[model samples]
Target: MANQPQDDRTSKQQAIDDWLPITSSRNAKWWYSAFHNVTAMVGAGVLSLPYAMAELGWGPGIAILILSWVITLYTLWQMVEMHEMVPGKRFDRYHELGQYAFGEKLGLWIVVPQQLIVEVGVNIVYMVTGGKSLKKFHDTVCPSCTPIRSTYFIIIFASVHFVLSHLPNFNSISGVSLAAAVMSLSYSTIAWAASLRKGVKPDVDYSYKATTNTGVVFDFFSGLGEVAFAYAGHNVVLEIQATIPSTPDNPSKGPMWKGVVVAYIIVALCYFPVAIVGYYIFGNSVDDNILITLEKPTWLIAMANVFVVIHVIGSYQIFAMPVFDMLETFLVKKLHFRPSFFLRFVTRTTYVAFTMVVGICVPFFGSLLGFFGGFAFAPTTYFLPCIMWLAIHKPKRFSLSWIINWICIFLGVLLMILSPIGGLRSIIVSATKFGFFS
Candidate 1:
């Protein structure tokens, strides 16, 4: 061992030292990691793509979707590259990268909030989506029963979510991740098939309308935000990467990138067909949730809704595990608390409860999706990655790489500003018809 080259020894040392407690016994094959990435990227947000397609015409919508996918893939790769920048250190969390890129304060202030919004915000969406689907399913099955509000269903789902959230870490829930990925595909198929059924049916009025009510400007921003949200899995990229096995000869990220590419390809396959077909069928009439627009053959639609609810229930945890890990670490280190089972249960339960309340209170589905996607996903997925790459790599100023990074930064900033405005406007407009908590 002592006779080995310095470079080889350092590589081996880095591989061994990089093994985190959270990552212990959790190493996954490339395909399994790919499955996780697919599950993480494809969530309840995909249901809204048709609505987004409607806002931006199919031509522009498809263009944006493809563009978003390419940009997101690049940014994800950039993030991985950033992880490898510091030779002997590993960044297993999003904020860790942020702290390295800028400073601790900025990471705490900016990156921490981004992670919370991505994780907690998505959980809130899951509650809202699962609750709505459960209500719809129940109402379909028991027409004569008393009409139960979505809020009640949300509480019921949260009870289950609280239990699931207690899973110790991300890798502990690999089974859930696999099941969620399957569920996502099942529902996506049902949705696509339903869209075809709706399109071909007689007496169904549908035509492709690019923009309505909202002007071109508003619709463009709204559509952009929705697309951004649909691909906002960048927040969990590092956590997933950490689970891949590392070897001295061939490190973890080699397989991790393979998984990412494979996963994203599947994501594109699932996403594009649904968006195009749903828009073709419903056109401007497509509901924010394409599934909601699906009604006939009540059993199938109901089954698909059930699948969505199941998928989100699992997905809520995939995103939340990192946040939970971060919070527990903070409490244990800064607050001098023990890493006790009791503390874990209390924190996880409380976090789930908080998301449940917010999900129930703010039932603005499309608006919330847009808000998070635009305001949060744009920066986290696109803007920050470019900035971090430039900061770490120190690409020559005014070079092509530098210019591209600047352009990405501008686009992210543009989305951050415009997306929130559009999302808020949608919420306000939506509120006129259905008041808060309705």
Candidate 2:
């Protein structure tokens, strides 16, 4: 009789644990979680940094990157804190956090579309990038084997991606992410080293200007969008956190800050050198994709492109998993659909097809990155997380924490407003140079 109350508590806790995603034995170690964060954070975005640096100049571009990194890390921790606030309840995904902080309808509206844009936009970018890389490799190897369009390669890559996207959950893809991370690091090194070797050739004009008069303010904000895109990994932070091991005594987020530190350090190490070296070598003439700017030993460049293809392939899955979960859950709960393998196959394949078609229709790579970076990245990374923290903690009005949150909220709103305009201007300018289909 004395122990009955304790037994009842244990049973209730067990019931709650069963409902949570993090209670599984499949939960990952700190290193695996760190790797997932790194994989999601570092992708084709790094390739665009040199061009951003060229626009903003080195000092401002580097400053923006560092500041973005710091703020993103803070927001990521705020997310972890919010997850802990509800105690036994699981806020294992961004949408859930949004719904918890706000209401269901509004919260979903706030997060879902932006989340979709970030994930699907990236997959489209990956398809375009992969297609281009394959075309480059094919052209280098078989110059006489007739010209193959990038669109065709994109279709072929999408078929393979459709197959890979069927992997059921996040934990299943950790090994793939690990391999992708290594590939990213490898190609980043190759691009940096190749640029160093190429140096500043006589024909290429180089400028290290602090500011540009060409587009003036428009150019600055556009460059800021590019830099923001480079660090916009907050969309998947909660998903990565969900993969970390959890226990009653030691919540999943216990080692999350340490993991975040390790991952972002690796991200900065990989990003900064590539941006600086690529811009140092090519200056204002740097191509949006730095790998494209390399005109050296054919085989090495080809190898690097191949690595980029692989890295993006893995990255597409990492970002898409959360989107997949949300859609699947909605189908299961709201639509009363059974959570069967057939349902999973149908939904996942349909999502892949949708992204593929979008990739084909709007093949403008840099423009898409800029647009998504501004439209989605600002709100998701900066504004929502800070606001959620404020709402959940109810920090004192006009207090230090409150003041910081407000400042972050303002910055997020500013970026949200400016980035889209800048991105649109960039798209229009690029469209003038190239057609929509091009």
Candidate 3:
């Protein structure tokens, strides 16, 4: 028989119970998460790979391309598992998923570093890249204008970050995110148009120069970690999922999934062309900021400069918030005297100021992507999620392929650790191999 119309009620109730929104005044406008994801992912575009393409040629660059896709797809698979288990539940951090599946200790350990890299490491890179981009624009367009002092740029960048960070909540930020997207997209398009005009033929055979034999396997592992960090927008999923309204009938129920999909699509499109073109033009001579490949109209370069600078403010705000919040909650909560909101604001302001100064002071800070990719990327993106999935799903209870899965997990962890070390070494040793600027 048609059997009492089955039990749709249970699933419906589950969805409703799971729906949680991000606690911000801008509740009505919740799509900011998507914008942030897109921006964060694309932020990597400004870095040194274009030059790697110049060095390695298109074939190896294409290898890097494939590697990036594999890593992103694997992370995405883990995220899908995360969504299914929790459904609409809002998780404050990536490790929250781990906590749900495993326990608090493991979850915290895994997520803490992940959050730092995303918020702190990535943000620092953004600021540095933004600074470099602005400097280029200034030199090109306003050659006679006095070069921007680092202090002046830092103050301007930090002030903008403070103002934006204080906005009513994420909803307002989401709107700004859209504007950022348009600006970034326009910059990419213009840059592409200019790049195409150069009329460089793609080189099929870019010689493989293994600067150091770190072992092929180790190099691949290092490459894997770099790729994983490059594509990690996964934390957004946990938070966004938690923010979503869990109503059974609501089709757009999982905003995290929706946001990620939207963001990845935009990021992939924006990055691929730039990487491909940059490789073609520079032929192993590409700089970290791919725009350096373009000798374009002053207007285009100026627009790029302004947008990168503005985007840095939003990035730094996101980077510093959790750090400040964690400090206050863990330390200040027990302390007798609490600072007022304005005072707290000042505290955070001071902390960011310090980071800006330190970030600018260090010559090697720009290599953050490689550094964190080795140290933090694996545990968060691959190993932790796999562990969490096993914990949450309890695969043994369900008669799943435990042996194979665990093996994969171990290998993932090993590779994650190995990858960044190799990459970091490569960056440093590249100098020695080629003999002090070979």
Candidate 4:
């Protein structure tokens, strides 16, 4: 070991030493900091409300509420464990913890793909969201003009993202970030208010009931991916721990878990109401983007759209940055591409362009959200972290049935597979009906 070169340590290994400390002044209290984390998770979760409402209606719309209970329990347990594992280390990326907990190979396979999904999904989301927001704004501003188009807006927004991603201190957009938080709350509150005003009752008519029946089995599993994806952003713990003061005596005891818990609570409060109201107002008719259900004033919809657009952009960067950092580190070290400025630009531009194309081709949030949630996030969020916990801790006493854990994992996997298919079918059918494919 002494014979090894100093530069040989991997980035993952280096990050462990630079881990941020957890101190009162360094880390914000749960009250002040939790909403940031919570809102990010809710961003992805809220996007799927319209779709979930359409399939399951108000009865199973409560599935989101139910799932929050299960997710909270699972999250609390995970936080307890994470608090023990990651105090002093500068946990920059997911794989650092993965490598520390498990071995390198497992970390590479598990963390890498998961991060990719998050980044790509958020990018696609930003494009779709920004485009939609721009479309709405255009319509509001020029209701008499020809149908408002989104081509130019997409380009402008994408350009801004590229520029914003490169800024050093442009880490958080305070106003936009705050609006994302507030708009999410507002959207949910308004949705609930709308439901109450409209008197959204359960359909008692036999034909209405039968047609709306999302089979119990399908609803049970199908909803898992959506919920999993919605809650997957909890790994923000990696970022949260960075600002805390790291000391040996106080290393493990920190406020980060409090932040995580607080964040989850805010998320639950914001998302549950929105899901309930969404299902209440539209019943099975809710589209995937719940914003479509709003028969509100143009100003309100436009405001909501603006916030959603900014929220998507912020999310896109969160997922995008670490991946970019990892790739840049690899390229500079291995491929010798670090010396050239143009090469760096080319690399980033390529990534930006790829995301753009994906966003354009897959314009709808409903299908994209489902597919990403089911396939990518389900494994990372629900299954992988728990697996990592078991692998690292090797807890001899799990009184809780491993049977339930396995069942959750199996159901997670199944939902991931089904959400995409069902979501895509819904999109295709809608598109065909609208003459886009016909």
lDDT of 3 by residue, 47-152 (tens): 4445545544566557766655555555655665465454434444465666676677876775776777766676665656666666766787888988775545
Candidate 4: residue 120 lDDT (0-100):
70
TM-score of 2: 0.90
lDDT of 4 by residue, 339-377 (tens): 345655666677777777666666665455665667777
Off by over 4 Å in 2: 1-26, 201-214, 436-438
For all predicted structures, in order, the TM-scores are 0.90, 0.90, 0.78, 0.79
lDDT of 2 by residue, 60-163 (tens): 87787777877888888788767656656557788889998889888888888998888778777888887778888888767799897778888987887788
The RMSD of every model to the true structure, in order and in angstroms, is 3.7, 3.6, 6.7, 5.4
Record all residue pairs in model 4 with backbone atoms less than 3 Å apart, i.e. clashing: 19-89, 19-90, 21-244, 21-245, 21-246, 22-244, 22-245, 23-245, 374-416
Report the lDDT of model 4 for residue 70: 76
Error of 1 at 37 (Å): 1.1
Residue 75, candidate 4: Cα error in Å is: 3.7
- lDDT (C-alpha, whole model) for all candidates: 0.79, 0.79, 0.56, 0.58
Instruction: Give the residue spans of candidate 3 off by over 4 A.
Output: 1-22, 25-31, 44-47, 54-60, 80-89, 201-205, 209-226, 248-253, 331-340, 396-415, 426-438
List clashing residue pairs in candidate 1: none
